[model samples]
Target: MIPLPAGRTAPRTAPVTAPATAPAGRPAPGSVPPQRTASGRPAPGAEPGRDLFVDVLRLLGMALVVLQHWSMPVLSFGDGRIATGNALAAGNMWLVTWVSQVMPLIFFAGGAAGAISFGRAARRGLPAPAWVAARLRRLVLPVVPLAAVWLPLPHLLLAMGLPEQPVLTAARLAGQLLWFLAVYVAVVALTPLLVRLDAAYGLRVPAAMAAGAVVVDLVRFAGGLEAAGYLNIAFVWPAIHQLGLRYATGRPRRPWLIALAGYGAAAALVAAGPYPGSMIGMPGAAVSNMAPPTLALLAVGAGQIGLALALRPCAMAFARLPAVSRVLAWTGPRMMTVYLWHMSALCVVTAMVVVGLGISTPEPGGPAWLAGWPHWLLLLVLALWPLLRAFSRFEMPRPAAPYTGGTVRIAVAAGLAAAGLLLFTAFGFVPGPAPLAGAGLLLSALLLGRTAGPARRNAVPAPGTRR
Candidate 1:
């Protein structure tokens, strides 16, 4: 979910390995070759060229997430409560998530981008603590505006005599989306260690993680230890992430074979095992493939990665067209804002159409629903545009003075930020102190990331070090 540059195009056959001129003429795992411009010089610092395939995948994954969220949700308001149901819960729609559920791809792309970016910083002598601090700032800052609005808005709405249930619903739903951020925070915080492990062990690291996931699932299912399922979070996401780390340094051989094997494994899991067919959770289902993400989800993720590799040539070609380039460039910078607020946009549209105007949603798969879908999408877009404009400024964090903080301080800052996001994920911004406390933690983390003013000026005297 990390925001990366998206404008520049690279050759469709861009090298995925370190340059041949490097010592030993063999690229080290997790090392990115320096990118060059057409004139054979390094690409500009501010706008270094990006892998077109990764950029395209990131944008497309985000777009699909938004579309799926916007299009689902069957809503109606009555008795001071807004009833909700999933349109995708309707028959046969669950199959679509195989392609549309792109969280794995997002994390994969993030890992790839992190690998390349960290490699470049390492080459330039940037410390690990400083790199992690900068990444925390980018991930946590955009969330400030979101918290500011939500933490107070619920209280204000309740004071105005609005129904408590609906207000609380919106608040919880808003914060629930932060689960991704919380997990990603942990992922990013551990990136330095993970990258090192990847460099040393290569595919063996992910292979080990996958084995752990299989063990967890077996223990979980066999013993009926539902709580034990959460342990897979440690195993599942990082395994997929390691794939991205590998892909950044080199393409896989026979990617289509991977796709075949992955899909076959997933099909077997769903058919012969307890896993559900849907990648995303559905209401009233006996089991959810998503809530604790099963082995099936990981299998499907592998399939998606392999499929993406198989289609890289065409995807990059399509991404290079002038119109597509413009859209990618424009959306890239603002993608974070769009993601954070898209649900809020859904709430606004829901309130206006369902609560204010008393318009109930049509039944899924009905003609009315089919007809109203486009207009519903248009209304959501209308609601979202202003939000995009208002909050996009926070997407690019204000550059902080070079971090003079120690590794412990950087680690603490990251911990505080992750804790805050986790708090929101667990207990949302309802009319309570949790939201305020979460916001305080985030601000504290940001402060810790800053350099000490007087101390830096007077005491920084090391040779070759800047105050």
Candidate 2:
């Protein structure tokens, strides 16, 4: 969750850039003084100085997600067509994922970013509806294009010579990642309320949510009420999401101890508290703590937060290097784009190698697959550049007007985004009504947002672009 800074006087728009360096003279309280690097460009690390670990963790989380998708599907050509199955389906190695699950940190960062962005707007007298609208709009734009392409993709594959199974597989491969997007939108929708809860109750709120998750998991596993576990989506994420509560409350305390305690608890639960070891799912495994999050996953995230905090000072120090700062600066603004399109990039490579190149499956980790991995990575990177260039404009910070829209409209827009996100996650973008419904819902959100204040384009060029 990148806390994209909003402009105070006017409605803020997309692709927030570094504010210009202010003069050396001391600035007024509650205002940021600008700074630049040796390159004379805005030193992204300096001005308003975003937390490096947040950026680091975010980038790392996104990368791991891509890697997971990139590596998970075991693809091979058979009967002159591409076929795939999950590697995790077989091995008990999923136990490693208990410690490897990083999405907790991702959601935690999302909460903090939402808190920061909304707080900035509130200070400027920006309406709450508009603030929520602005946040949702940024989150939704990337999905529009994705749906546009994917909704029709299945039908097109069927029309082609491709078989039904492979076509459906491709469509699923494209859409499976939307679960994160869906859950994220829901958590974000609840941000303002969650922040309020923190203000009133402090740590108790997250503790309560975590406790509720424990109960849900207990019933889900004990009584075979697997459906009941879905509640953990609301429960488990908020538990981790609320860790940002400390930030929103202006209470500064050392979190390393909490992090340590979390890991200890998570390990104990996995080891002896009757929970499974893996934080992720295996295709045929009896229980998956991931698909419907469980206490094990939440504990993993809590511990991860602690680990991240314990390392922040060192991360910040390393981030200070000018080269690293510049890179972070570039990646920070485009993080959303990367998250949206990275999977698409991998899919493109899979298409080329398995379907196009007619490469057979390499015996599930046999020599041929290992030999081609470098080639696979190279192809994935090659496919990504053009996709980013074409689609990133959707993410440009558009000029926004003050939201005067009533709370009802805000709820409607959020409802649309949330519902649409859930639909997409459950069923990957599909033909006919699915795309229309999801994209249409998000599109309605944008329309409602404009009523608050119409977006007005600013003269500031999108950073790093050639005029």
Candidate 3:
């Protein structure tokens, strides 16, 4: 959820080479302020100091997500493709459980980024609808290409006489990754309201909200009322959402203190047995607090955020290096694309290994055969880089503008997408030829609408700005 800056470049970290001393009263060499634009703004490619920190955090978050997915073990596969069941054994569950809370961390960071992006757009006098449109375009655009490429691959394999279970297994796993986009879209739509909440009640409101979510979860757990626990999906996650808004506004006097409280609460809940000690333990435990996230999870997120803040100094230092900065700059723009496609890339690699290399599946809970997993993972990572490069362009944000003539076109596209989803539901459609074809049509319509440009004259860039 790192918001791509409207026009800013990544920070540079090339070391300054200068003499030890300057002539009397002269400014120290390489100490002069970076040059500014003709309009007194930092030059187009110059990174803003505050934004550098945001990018670093974003990079870290993405890395954690990648690692979590990589470490996840696959269990049973339908059609030998899509993952169907938990691969975790009792022993390994404890080790991998903490990864459950990672998504919440990602969303919290996203909420913060969204607040900043929308706040800035508002200041430029961008209308709410326009801002929403632009955000949706950036979020939704890359998904099209990913779905297009991946949806049919499994079916093609099946047609080529590949086993049914393996093909279906891979397709299902790929589809699950789309959940991020669905959740993120919902969160982004709420950004404006959350920002307003921050402006009015400050951090206290979100803190209180989080507490309430926790209480609701605890009561539900104690009473054995499963439906009640679902409330947490809305409450606890949104509470974190509001916290992100608070971070964007920069109003808290002691963020560290708030974060500590969250950590303490999380520890107490886990100890109390309201939730599992491992955030993502093996499937079929008597109590799976995470199935319906408990207060404990929220506590963990708060603690993590505090921890992130604690490392701000180190993150800033790392972000200032030129090579590191450039990589972040390049990757940040394609964050969503990478996220959506990484699992697909892994699936491709796995297929190649099993079919092309004749490798047998490793024993469920034993060491992966020959310790070859590291090599496999490395290859997957390498393959993903070039794949992402080719596809990231679809994900880049379009310049902002007003909607005009394309309203009907956009509506038709949305209608088609809705229809396709309904059809899939009724027919039990798998990710194969028909679904992929539908996706292509929907994506084409979306792209055309986005590229058609702002529909009206007032859609021009705001005075003295480049949003």
Candidate 4:
């Protein structure tokens, strides 16, 4: 969700080096002066100043996601292979997913951030296709470094006499995280249209989407057609995304009321309907609120949006503190980097502890686990630090000549990129033609993004290299 500047080559920490406010006559670097409508309110998408609330929410949600992923796994090694279980699968532990499943918040933040970004682009006379292309490039570039390392890793491990199952497990888990990026690409591509829909219909847009989600849930549960549930991917997430669009216009008048209504509906669904209580999928659970995204999850998402809005003042206040601001500045640009590579870091630590040292995870909620949790967390941070340092640069690539192509070609390019991400998510980087094909599609997308207007020097630099 970080809005990386184009062609930025400054040190990674350069983003927040300046004071938040500038002298009387001069605006601070990267600060947008507010543009207001006739009502004396900031214009939609033209709200001046950094959205401290959105930044904090995105960072906190991502951090919690990383912690949850790292802590949930209970690994056991035997017979030259590894088996994995979820610590959260234990009795009554599902309650925690209500708060820990933060994707709704992430999508909300993305919607607000995308509004601001596209607003700025429109004001600068940039077309929608150009803006979409730029965002697509940013999304795809980071994945290149991931693919470069992971595509050949399983083969090397197998050649090194490592067991196939363990190696495949590690590789697949690493790639599975790309599912977010795939869904996000589709959302980004459609934002220009979605924002316009928001302007025209207000809450009705999301209301209609929510109604569609409920009907899809009926088809999924009542008719026993599980495949029908996936249709909510269109209805549910964009509905949440629409709420974010509404937020961009103004803060909710009574967020606590919104929160009460949302959570109340979610609770009703779980208690009286077939929906499961957990927002995330649990091992061995007959119903998962997350994978196919039930109406229960949408209700919880609405509640999360309201809860976050209610806390915005306090969160924004804390985000402005000198210490917190510095952390946000450094971490903001690397949010996507951290999201993409955190699982890889987990893979590394898992290998070292479970496969190498022969240490298996302790029992969930047991005395040993309570005692060892801090040590486990420390190891993960240690493993992730070097990765953050190494791959963070890909977050900003030098600019390509603005994709000067018409909308159709841009759509094609974005489609190819999404397809590539889906390939990685579905087939994984397990040694074979799938990873190679994914890499090719990504490269082809980049190549296709160039314009025929000027002499093309392979417009985009290779993903991880400096020009």
lDDT of each: 0.77, 0.66, 0.59, 0.78
TM-score of 1: 0.89
- RMSD after CA superposition, every candidate: 5.1, 5.0, 7.8, 7.0
Model 3, 1-467: lDDT tens digits are 33232322211111111122446754333222333456875543344323555667667777777766665555333334444234454464554545444766676667666666665556556655555556656666666676666566766887899877766666666656554454465556566666666677777777787778867776787777777886776666777777766665453446588678867887677777757776653456766656566777777777777777666668767766657756865676777767777777777776776545656546545677338567767987987888888888776644555534344454454444444433332322265466655565556545644534544555655211245
Q: On residues 231-253, what C-alpha lDDT tens digit does candidate 2 reach at each position?
A: 99989987887885454333234
The better-scoring model by lDDT among 1 and 2 is 1
- TM-score for candidate 4, please give it: 0.88
Deviation from native of the Cα of residue 341 in model 3, angstroms: 0.7
State the TM-score for model 3. 0.76
Q: After the best TM-score superposition of candidate 4, give how far the Cα of residue 363 lies from its true spot, in angstroms.
A: 1.2
By summed lDDT, the worst window of 10 consecutive residues in model 2 runs over 9-18
lDDT tens digits, residue span 112-183, model 4: 767666665665466788778778878888888999999988989999998788899999998887877877
**Who is ahead in TM-score, 1 or 3?**
1
Ranking by TM-score: 1, 4, 2, 3
Q: In TM-score terms, which candidate is top? A: 1
Between 1 and 4, whose lDDT is larger? 4
Q: Rank the candidates by lDDT, best first.
A: 4, 1, 2, 3
Task: In model 3, state the lDDT of residue 130.
Answer: 51
Error of 2 at 307 (Å): 0.3
Error of 2 at 437 (Å): 2.6
| Model 4, CA-based lDDT | 0.78
